[model samples]
Target: MSDDPKTLVSTDWLANHLKDPDLRVLDASWYLPDAGRDARAEYHAAHVPGARFFDIDEISDARSDLPHMAPPVEKFMSRMRRMGVGDGHQIVVYDGAGLLSAPRVWWLFKLMGHRDVAVLDGGFPKWQAEGRPTEDLAPVVKDRHLTVRYQNQLVRDVTQVSQASKLGTTQIVDARAAARFRGDAPEPREGLRAGHIPGARNVPFNTLLNTDQTMKSPDQLRTVFEGAGVDLSAPVITSCGSGITAAILGLALERIGHDRWSLYDGSWAEWGMFPTVPVATGDA
Candidate 1:
């Protein structure tokens, strides 16, 4: 598997680079309310050495009613500054839930036009499983300036997603579970309609991972997307329950060198709740 610093890296790669002067590790752990796991408490208990906690909820655009929307540019800059992550730092983000939620933070960095960030493949679980070093002490902090060059092409609004769903020029890929995509299972959040987006293809984010929770190889990722009827030659828009797991699909697309993919920031959370947007039920 490719361990590109800008996309993904393995536990071995992280272990070797942990002591680099410019390296920064972030525990970007987040869990669903039903999961009963507290990300902050988990980090306090034990985490990768020198890793700082990056709260997905707190580091987001709190002004938005929706869950964990991308934070404002100024807010992001201040937060990263407080966290001692800034210009010229190589960031490695890992989540407690293997590879589940960390990619979202990585994508956020990319959205802000940072290129030296990556998600830790297999994440904290695999690192702990390998008996790597852990600690409960907090990291040393220092303020640092972070430059912002927001990349609008990496993000899509609800209006753009609606247009893409109507016009087949761009592929809309849903990363929710099959049951949810088919309207057979209820959404974890209340006040939302069921089913996938019209003309969207389903490719559950978990399917892109292996049993060990590490991502599949590049060829395997390509096969998964193609098997779901995605056109690699064209652009794609990745969506999920609330724009979290959608980044997993975006990461997979990046791993396969598919450079024309963008993420729907509102995702199903906004679309499902809006009675105005048309949603498709059953398999695509």
Candidate 2:
């Protein structure tokens, strides 16, 4: 509906195009450990009609110690092929928690060089609230070959983030809350230090969303980023707790037409665990 089918889509757009042969809906629900909800169980209980479950954790780079690193090209291709999603298909990923976690999957599709993927604006909760159709049945699947280009430019490692932080050439935006960014609140994940990357600005992922959990308008999103001292002209590198919510920032940047951006995949999870990287605290 916003004319960017590769970034986001309204619930109305999805509902109207639900029966399209080339449309592939994915239930990509994931919750933080403390949230106490099982994503798989919930998907099995209810999901958008003809939607397939996309397990974020299971379909990732398991070799990495960090939580749910982006899956390798082969893994992504295999998983998507197994789900009957392939070239020429329009992907719409959604989560149980409105805007949460869905963007991660959307980003993944992009990183894997799939341009037709998009996140369901407002996700499952909003769809249900609007009285849209949902079903407990799993859709039939047929294998479809998937080709991945693997866009390395869309992801950043810890070393790259550290370099960017020290150089100040790029804007390092943290998606964690102000409290977490300032070390005023404890991290939800264990054994990680508080505070944020040096010179990084805080723009909590929630600040980019409206009350219904849909992303704010492009102009409003620009205002939110500018208010946080992010320079729109500079390239941006977004980071968050374990790189999950960071994709929310990435999506926001994409919505605002900021094409020169990447997600710090390691984020605070790796930076906070390492002794070599510097961490800054407070609102300075």
RMSD of candidate 1 to the true fold?
Answer: 0.6
TM accuracy, model 2: 0.98
Off by over 4 Å in 2: 1-3
lDDT digits (tens) for residues 47-137 of candidate 1? 9999999999999999999999999999999999999999999999999999999999999999999999999999999999999999999
Error of 1 at 34 (Å): 0.4
**True lDDT of residue 61, candidate 2:** 95
The TM-score leader among the candidates is 1
User: What is the alpha-carbon lDDT for the whole of candidate 2?
Assistant: 0.93
> Whose lDDT is greatest here?
1
Candidate 1's C-alpha runs over 4 A off are none
What TM-score do all the candidates reach, one by one?
Answer: 0.99, 0.98
After TM-score superposition, the amount by which residue 160's alpha carbon in candidate 1 deviates from its true location, in angstroms, is 0.4
* Candidate 1, residue 118: lDDT: 94
Query: What C-alpha lDDT does candidate 1 achieve relative to the native structure?
Result: 0.95
